[model samples]
Target: MPMEKTEKTLLSKKELLEIFVNHRVDSPFPGDWESVFKGLGYEFWALRELEPTDSFKNIDWKAKARTGKFFVRDFLAESYFNVMILYDVSRSVQFGRKELLQAHIAVSLAYSAIASNDGCGLILFADDIVKYIPPRMGRTHFMEILDAIVHAEPVRCGGTSLGPALTKLLNEVPESLTFILSDFLYPLDFGYTFHHAAQGSTKHEVKALQVLEECEIALPPGTKGILPLYDYESGRTVSLDLTKWQAFNDTMSRQREGTRTLLGRAGIDLLTVSPADDFGRKINSFMRRPPSTY
Candidate 1:
């Protein structure tokens, strides 16, 4: 499929808002959004007279002042879940139209979550965590996330450090339906990190969306001679023999399969998306599918 010309880069706020509106009117997922998060978290239930065993932290100070009685807030386990987007702003993702694709996917999911009254958060990272917005539910919060994504630029020097980013998320954030969006072009081995994060005390539901350009997967047809490729993160260039295009394709294919296998074993679903694909619909389909088990 041909790429949409307008989507070759991140869209403006107006464009993003339009997409959000459309998604609310015509959601692609099948059942109610609440069903997607069954058995996940809790929501506020009610307030009742404070019991002797109730902690002082739960006491409603305002209620005590108003009615001259102690009351404590209560919660119920429910369908609420945090939707966290961990985006890679590393130089590698600066490749042809990858960031644009990331923005589309992130915006769609954030809007969907907020529309369903679920909390949505964002973490932008490269060599480390660049920015983080804790999961929150509101139009203002969604706009903050949208602003961060639209203005996000790739880090100028360092390669991706997904290990630290994942570590931070696992340690700090609550259990969430987390989505990692990146090109997965870094050389780091983060398989163990992913495994630990998925199976940690929090038991986060992790998913990954690998954004890539079509040419990155395979060289153009009828390519010949030496092709010079530049490494964005390293500021280095390497010459490749086009005669070895098939070898390059084989290596890339293996790398992709290896990633899928590793994340699958960690119980994380992996979806590879390209600028030419219908990413919104693809993301909806991916979300509908259950996470893979080891």
Candidate 2:
């Protein structure tokens, strides 16, 4: 018998989109999926009472038959879309094995947004706002945003804060789709800040992409040794005994649950992906899916 060898080829943007369209989640989050991925063109409005000037092509005959009333489909022409990408460049992101993965995810989404004729913006933040590239349409602007994020320097700070950066975004950009990408390992009080940020967005939808390392998610069951962990953001060093390590893992578990709860309550759609998962598929799952109305 002969041996078989396989070569892996890189997937193009078109191929990635095909995968998304061909395969859908079991139960998609209820949202306006068509408007989110289709970019600028026309949006389907609710079926309403037919007007004298309404075209026959736009008429919803099924609705007319079912409800026993004349109704016509309405469409609103949308010129363009503004997609704001908020990526965390705190030192903590630079510490793990998946250091560059976060940027890759951000870059992918940014590419998709721009390719779809939407204005893509970049906001690199840590404890404070590091850099802000206002949303602009075109390949050149998207490339500039990508370059800034890929070459960004990690900040040395005590912790990550979304309040100041989000507050700034709320004040500057209006009616944009905001994407916040981070590991989200922050202090307890930061939750309040998150709630405040989400609450303040009146006309925008917030999509959260949480990047986490495998170890951060959970430890092996047999792990029973002392461990040395470093806080990259604060430049602090700490030694943990076996008991303390378990407690730390417990705290991380609780934090994950708390984060899910907080974001859910704020009506934010969260997609948690890890380095171990298929990056393209996971990203497509998040970006291409319908927004959650829950």
On TM-score, the leading prediction is 1
Range of the 10 consecutive residues with the lowest summed lDDT in candidate 1: 28-37
Query: So what's the TM-score on candidate 2?
Result: 0.68
> Candidate 2's residue-wise lDDT over 72-119, tens digit each?
765543657678888888889876634466665666667666666778
**On residues 141-164, what C-alpha lDDT tens digit does candidate 1 reach at each position?**
987898898878788856677777
For candidate 2, give the lDDT of residue 5: 11
Query: Which runs of model 1 end up more than 4 angstroms from their true locations?
Result: 1-78, 189-201
In model 2, residue pairs whose N, Cα or C atoms come closer than 3 Å (at least 3 residues apart or on different chains), thus clashing, are none
Instruction: Judge candidate 1 at residue 203 and give its lDDT.
Output: 57
- On the 0 to 100 scale, the lDDT of residue 202 in model 2 is 51
**C-alpha-based local distance difference test score of model 2:** 0.66
Candidate 2 least-lDDT 10 residues: 1-10
